[model samples]
Target: MSEQPPSDCFICRKHRGEISIPGGAIYADDLVYVGHAQIREGQTIAYLGYLMVEPKRHVPDLAALTDEEARALMILVTRLSRALKATENAERVYLFVIGENVHHVHIHVVARYAGAPKEYWGARVDEWPAAPRGGTQEMEAICARLRVYLQKESG
Candidate 1:
């Protein structure tokens, strides 16, 4: 993979600019940012708490991650998963290591709602239909909520 600037990669740019979706980012250190993913215009995936834990550096694969990136990833996933279940009211938090469409290393942490289908569990979780998405104001609110929770945990 060619070198991608923080602004060029989907996850990387999110580390620097306006969050494109609701519940976008909760935390960021020198290595990564815990944020949300972008959706196709017509397609929606999982429920809220659909977060993306992304490395601030434009890393292309998991095997390429530094020791710090790997360690932070472990910490973020464990903490963020709990944060989703507790604060976002998710029964389960689904995680996906997405490097297919984009080359960067990003983790998808999706919240499973009250009646999420078993068929859509595991790898197929991304196929679920997410409706009633919030607009910018709502999105910002969600981000703020997660940010607070993450901050508390980090502190």
Candidate 2:
């Protein structure tokens, strides 16, 4: 492996504290940092509960994960999914591990709400309309809720 990950990598910058983490952490440990996804500018359909489970170290992709990281990834993803369902009324959670856009290994855990359009079901859920892409306050309120549920469950 290289002595250090490329400085320009967006995810690496988050790990380096160069960029502030969005939504903060719902649950985190030495292996992972679980937090809400950063809704991009002009983004609408991605709501507050949309989240990411990111590896703390520089694991470039799924193929690069260590044994410990893999186990923690599964546990964190499952816990986050359950928290979303319980607190956010998500009917199902959509999980996708995509590395093409970012070098760091981050798994997206998205909430699929009840009454979501059939056309947007299955592979098309990403196209479904979001409930409300509220501001940081709204999003943080959600993060706080999820954090509470997670703490109880994890404890």
Q: What C-alpha lDDT do the candidate models reach, one value each?
A: 0.72, 0.78
- Taking the candidates one at a time, how many backbone clashes does each contain? 1, 0
Residue range 20-109, candidate 1, lDDT tens digits: 555555787888787655555775432445777877788788999989889988898888888877777878787788687788888888
Q: Give the C-alpha miss distance for residue 141 in model 1, angstroms.
A: 2.3
lDDT of 2 by residue, 22-94 (tens): 5677777888887777777576434757888888888678898999999999998998889889998999998
Q: Could you give the C-alpha RMSD of every candidate to the true structure, in order shown?
A: 2.8, 2.6
Q: How does residue 48 of candidate 2 score in lDDT?
A: 59
TM-score, candidate number 2: 0.87
- What is the overall TM-score of model 1 with all chains considered together? 0.81
